[model samples]
Target: MEIDAIATAHAKRLSVADALLPTPPNWDAAAGTELSVRDGVALATRSRVDAGSPEALWRPLTEYRLNVRLGGADPGAAFGALLTEWDQLLEESEASDWDSAAVVTRPSRDTVGTSELLRRGFAPTRVLAVRPADRLAGGPPEVPGVRIRHAEPSELNTLVRLQLELRNYDEQFGVLTRRTDEERALTSATRELLADADSALPSLWIAELYGKPLGFVQVEVPPAAGWADSYVAAGSAGYLASMHVAEEARSSGVGSALAAHAHQLFDEAGMQAVLLHHTLANPRSTPFWYAQGYRPLWTSWYRRPAVQG
Candidate 1:
């Protein structure tokens, strides 16, 4: 397929993503074989495989998408280091005779290597933050009738409902309101990551008020490779992968409570700083994140309709 032909169309479809992140519509990665966008940065590359082992299927998910990892025969490859050098990889992919494939990265302050990727011409897609230590030191103000607890498997439906409701998407990517499939994906990814101690630790936290689930945040610790780095080893950082608060619960301190809980959990685990990502398209998240002590680390995204076609 001519990537250019799909570039604009892809961007339009991805516009929905902007609701959650500051992302573009499409990007040209492998000279012009494929298109990708994460937080508005689109990348193009040739398809690497039309069909492959489970591991191969997962490569794309983990390499460039936000969905959690999958279990079963899927490959659970780690892109931690590869992401730091994405531009170089893109160059190599372009030079190689291999089939093309595109990948995207969302906004996140923990992505310190993004600036380098931008210098290599990867493109800017989103704005994100790394929260400072002591940012969430104060205990959360009590929400009457609300209780914070470790979510049980039975609560997965409630958790997923709250997750989708907060996003205003009764469905995503054609999936129905019922998220048994998505929940499986999350569980599979979490399980795979956990079974492999070297992989990043995935912690899923949810908030409930009076038997009603409100919101949640899924935080992932650095993968094993990050453990050796002085920056990470020094108890310097924790990553907030995704956070959401339901509309009904917004302005009700549910978010702050969840955030404070995340902060405390990370702090107790020895992280001195907390990092996260936000979509520039979301007017509310940026300001709220800022108030919570986050700052931009780098910007990345693909070509949107707003940019030159």
Candidate 2:
């Protein structure tokens, strides 16, 4: 195990490139160690080396996985090297008393090389792609007695409540990714954003059927350069942060209505494209977005080894 800093400039570059690529444990950045496994697999496990108790390199791997958040690094060569090294190390380590081993990696075009890691000897794994949804060229369904309008300050709480219930976001990604206080803060922040007069900021759109709240969609304005740069650089445009519809209203064209309304807003604004990520693991969303005509631009995988495998 090599915990010390890498001497070679390229090795250091690998570390920086890894850092640049978005991973889960972002703010928890810390000093990392390069450890050797059974068959010469070199695993780079990181820890908050500056914290009070910085555990050993293999400690977290044994207990729980540290998620990788893909930022903007080209995983083509760096990730391939990481996987190859780890595979070699694992083969050598399997003969020892060690029960299991795993490595964090982003999925690439070469699915064959990735699958071989399991065939050759790695344990249980997964490949999840984060799919983005885009708007279609059309208008929403004309639900009788339903009208779309700009969200008002008075409807802020209602919007939050509807979003919590309709999207099941609170359970799906919110609770897992945010604390109770964080959720409350997010709700308030959205309301404040609605009241702001910044033209470059995102806008919140509301849908009402027979004077009742049907759903809402939020669109960030002026466009984000970091995330949408690739799509936008090639002439793609806009962003859809969050969209939700009431439970009873879903599948009744309300979701499409909200999306179409957003498309109208984008078209009016002269933007051509919109981008937003959805968890492929989510059942309701996978098909919903597909029906809306949004295709995947890229996919990110989450891999974990079984306890005994």
Candidate 3:
């Protein structure tokens, strides 16, 4: 069929999967490779990202990103056929030998063709979670020894260190790559995020133990997080960018306290919902976040290097 009809059909499928799912409405189908079958249709785009690019910091060193659309009653079979074409397209691309990944994101509740995804060697590596406003309705419990307070711009290095520890922790899962200049990028990224501060909105909060900082949570509310507003169907949404605690502070209630601190700010800002990403394979993260009332809204499935079988 036509690309316009494909877009409309793809959107309808996602809406049925999860009504709250923030559908990405536009991708230039004319520029992508498309395959139409008797019962369904598939469209995908192949784009590469260089390691040195700022976007690569969150993804693999280099990435052959895939934006796939499989729409029909029989998405399972259609998706299986799409993967065959996906492989052929990669083989014809120049970066087939590059150190990168072929990644696709789908609504968390979309399960029709996931068996094909796994059989084709893809794994769900990341999750974008959603916590409705009601989750923050309850007050955060008091952690006796942990003091959660707003972080200062002067404490840039301190924030970066804690954030680095998080990245290092997530590395074991293979979703986050270690960059040569990670520290520099981490510092710059952190600095830029902190600079968008609002006098009335305390976006960053640090938790201290025995007068020593141990954990932090950086949250951006509406107006503060306007960039993320489009992702949610709610009146407004907040972003939980980063939250980390030192290794020594694990299981000491510091992280819990930090989340509570963030929830309080989200409540004050009149947020309708909050969005954040977490490594799906993380042993501790999934349970901890679920306890905080966050549930998966999107899942990012990937295979390292597009050539991987």
Candidates ranked, most accurate by TM-score first? 3, 2, 1
Candidate 3: lDDT of 184? Answer: 89
Candidate-wise lDDT, in order = 0.48, 0.49, 0.78
Query: Deviation in angstroms for 85 in model 3?
Result: 1.1
Best candidate, TM-score: 3
What's the true lDDT of residue 265 in model 2? 70
Model 1 CA lDDT for position 33: 32
Steric collisions counted per model: 31, 21, 1
Give lDDT tens digits, candidate 1, residues 184-234.
Answer: 555455445334434334366668867778887777555532532322223
Candidate 3, clashing residue pairs? 100-305
Model 3, span 258-285: residue lDDT tens: 8887887888888888999999999889
User: In what order do the candidates fall by lDDT, top score first?
Assistant: 3, 2, 1
Is 1 or 3 the stronger prediction by TM-score?
3
Cα-based TM-score, every candidate: 0.52, 0.59, 0.89
Residues 58-106 of candidate 2 have per-residue lDDT tens digits of 1222322222221113423333445655445444444232322243443
Q: How displaced is residue 101 in candidate 1, in Å?
A: 10
